[model samples]
Target: MSRTGRFGENLAINGIDGSYGWPVIGHTFDYLSDTYAFGRTMRARYGDVYRCSAFLQNFIVFNSPDGAEFVLKDEASQFSSKLGWEAFLGRLFPHSLPTMDFSEHRHHRRIMQSVFKKQALVGYVPLIDQVVIGNLRTWPTHQAMPAYPAIKALTLDIAAKAFLGLELKQDTHFINQNFIKLNNGLAAIIPWPLPGTALHQALKARSNIFNYFSPLIPQKRRSEGQDIFSRLCQAQDENGADFSDQAILFHLSNVLAAAHDTSTTSLTITLDLLCQHPEWQQRLREQCLRIDPQDITYDNLESLEEIEWVFREALRLFPPAPQLFRRSIKECQFGNHIIPANTQVMVDCGYIHRSEHYWNEPTKFDPERFSPARNEHKAHPYNWFPFGGGSHTCIGLRFAIMTAKIALYHLLRDYSVFATEQARYRILPITKPRNGLPVILTKN
Candidate 1:
């Protein structure tokens, strides 16, 4: 590995004719510094599909819409998510559905789906509305605040109330700290347990969540409450098979982390986008107001079609989980190119979203791209996978949309949102503003 920016002759690949790849260090340093940087560089040099070495593996990045389509919608088994994040998340959330595949994955996903259905969320409407209103009431009437942390608190509160049927005001700080530790664990370069390490703290947080929810699972079972947690406690498959207490707890933990974290990340991005585009924000605000602001019912929620489009656009620009990786199950040829088995494969959503062929003005903040008239995403289904595609698409997609819309509805009704000039934003794997998203909210 040379200190120089150029890869020395010693690190070149032979089979690809005169072409070269990364050497001993290869693109590892570049990737760690910024995966998007590497993707942009590689895509420019090698076109849509290119092979690069990372973390001591020959990884192929599918950078085009067609390439992603092949990777996601495979006829034969080729991709595996477990190979990428299982070892780390397994420790944090043992036996989660995402950590499994095939029959096992299907079985768990079926049980998980029961909790996220429209009927279940209908039951959560009052809980979500109350959480949003309660959090909004705490915001300073005419002060500037970082939107990420504020949205995080609101989303966490919603997760606590809607998922666990428990108010988290007394333990909000603890829960927030645990959530931060859990996210840091995922971002860690080394995903191993060490004394005082991020992974270790995340493991501890997992312990805390399980301990907090264990006793309540039985209580929910006894009372048979209308909340989703209670529904999960007694949910059964078509064959009458039910999840054991341990399985239920694992699923609950994963759901809470997934539902809240990704949604909060998404809401933060949405807030940032809305703040940046006040014309669109005013449009969305008008839409929300037209449907009776006092009554935040399910019907009114559904009528928020424009807000939904703005959210879809925000996700297009800044998806929370931007890059997806999978390992080859067997040796195969991708478009006549040999992709050997065990090769690391990546789907670069960030690049695909910015690609010129699929989108008209790729970088612009145009919510109309998602409108029924344009619906540019419909140009290529895989072109816009904010929540991924295929069988593994987010089961909680509808719930996430509802949560974002409801939060935005409340925020716009009483407050005006605009980005802070002093705030400089950065996009990590999760699209949070590196500097907290500072936004001025005036009482409207």
Candidate 2:
């Protein structure tokens, strides 16, 4: 399973290559510095596929659509995305679905799929709309507010009510603190188990979340409720096997993180773009006002074809999960190269989404590209994988889109968003807009 193809089998030492100032530790430094820089530098030097040694292991960057296919589809069984992510989230949520694999992975995925059923989503629409409308009332009429916090607040409330059945708005500080600690814990490279460390706080929040849901699951199992956790409590497979209490607890935790973070990120990007394009914002507002505002339903969401384009375009520009990683389970040959077992393969969707070969005027935020005529994404199925693809693709993609659109509909219809002169400057960790996106929210 040695390295094959043009790059050869040697471990990619960071400093030796003329690419970056690898120095003593070489490539490992850049890999940990930041994900964007790491992929950009490697692609700039290695063309499509390049091998480098980092953290004392051989790592490869698959920069092209074909390269991603090699790992994502060609020989997928030989790679594991959960391994690297598990190592990253080990301290805070090591027991969650993202950390399980093989038979255990399949068992959890089956039970989890039940919570996203048609009837379940149908009941969530009104609950989500209520949360969105209530939160928007707090925004100032003309002052610019940070879009990140606004959306983050909105999504958290929606998750609390719709997914976990907890009313968190009145308890904003507790809710926000729990989320901050959870995010900090996930980002800790070295386990944050030390007292007073960010990871420690995150671990405590994790425990609090589990304890909070423990009693809720039993109550939910006895009753038929619309919330996702209620459905998870009663979930069963075709064979009628049910999930245990521990499995339900972990699965519900996965729902909270997945439902909140991605929706917030996507909604922020949507508002950011709407602020930059007032005309589109008006168009969306008109679309929303036409609907019976009081009768917001899942079916009403499909009528929002135009806003859908804006959401897709934003996802293209800044996918919530920008980088994807997988570990080689076995020695495998890809094209002319042979990848050794245990080697980690990384794909930059951020780079691929903006690649000129796949997208026309890739940097421009034009929603028309997603129109039926252009359909830029049709160029390559895997090229526009913001939600990822294949067997392991996001199970909650439909829910993410539906939740985001509802929030955007309420926000855009009532307010016109404008980025401040100092806006657009930010950072990205789990999602871009590292700094909260500051913007003026003028009443429409």
Candidate 3:
């Protein structure tokens, strides 16, 4: 309630403990080099709630479930998702759901909710299976395959058909290339669209995407197709509000990116984990073998309980989006600290996901932790929120789960995946294998 002290000045006096590191650059290099190590070191030094500087900004890192609740729930409306995501995604995905706050976010979310509902999701299973099965068939067996890029391309193909309603023959290569550019821009240090910069190329890609989708909006609106694009075109809220032409483009761009990237990361990690743990992989494969390959539907997808647990463990170990960002709109109390307004707040879900305080053998890749008998994740609501929590929780979470389940079921059923060697990961920005997670897929 008291806005008595500025963020940096008199931090000790204000009871918030943290260091600003070096001037201007702050701890950007340290943080970027290895976010997991940096987070662990910080938490060890300062407990759960601490302040540190990164990427030229000071952030109060909340590395606990309670901190996750306070910032993510934002019960007092004291935080802004729009302001939080602006630094990362504003240039590429302006006015998208992630960049909207409070009532505006709710309004937009309501209109788009129908497209991701149970019925719609059920309709997508066959399409997803088609893409997954078709792509998996093309993967070379008995050799080391780069899983990340291969899966990334497959996810883009899935998105093209299921989300954009595009035919397989369409120019998905252009879409894939542009999306890669846009993703590269998220890590740009400059953040400006200056000539020859990653941001500049990303902005150009954004324009190209807009131009590609803009003319098609009118046709989609009039059509009766069931793909996400058509459903979004016909989406309307209780108040009869609909997405404008530009809103549709923005939502599609953001949704497409989130859909593919997160799913790709999740599938790749699950595959990697399964490869590393042959016992779990065999168990999951046995479960998958029980289901008739022709009958892989939304109804039967839930039967693969071990597969679900494996996916949960994979997300727990390496969340797709490690650190979630939020900016304070007003001074708020997080535990004992009085965080100043306009301060950037990061909920280190990645750190908390692996914290010793929460789980037994936290770093161990044991899927049984999520089994009903153990259920360690149930100890706290926020302990396992990979798709995030609260109002801004990913709308496509169910879709992501379904896609992963289907992809894993088919891949594991046909081929036995083996890790050639231990794979290293790049944690920040997004969790991905540094070496693309090379593995051999031997056909059964």
* Top model number, lDDT: 3
lDDT of candidate 2? 0.73
Cα lDDT tens digits for candidate 1, 367-397? 8888889889998878899787666788888
**Cα lDDT of all candidates, in order?**
0.75, 0.73, 0.86
Model 1: runs farther than 4 Å from truth?
1-29, 55-58
lDDT digits (tens) for residues 324-407 of candidate 3: 888888778876788887777889988988989998999999899999999999998999999888899999999998888999
Best by TM-score: 3
lDDT of 3 at 117: 97
Error of 2 at 431 (Å): 2.3
Measured over all alpha carbons after superposition, the RMSD of each candidate to the real structure, in angstroms, is 4.5, 4.0, 2.7
lDDT of 2 by residue, 261-335 (tens): 778778888887887888899888998898887878999898988889999999998787666667776777766
TM-score of each: 0.91, 0.89, 0.95
Clashing pairs in model 3, backbone N/Cα/C closer than 3 A = none
Clash totals, every prediction: 0, 7, 0
* Superior candidate under TM-score, 1 versus 3: 3
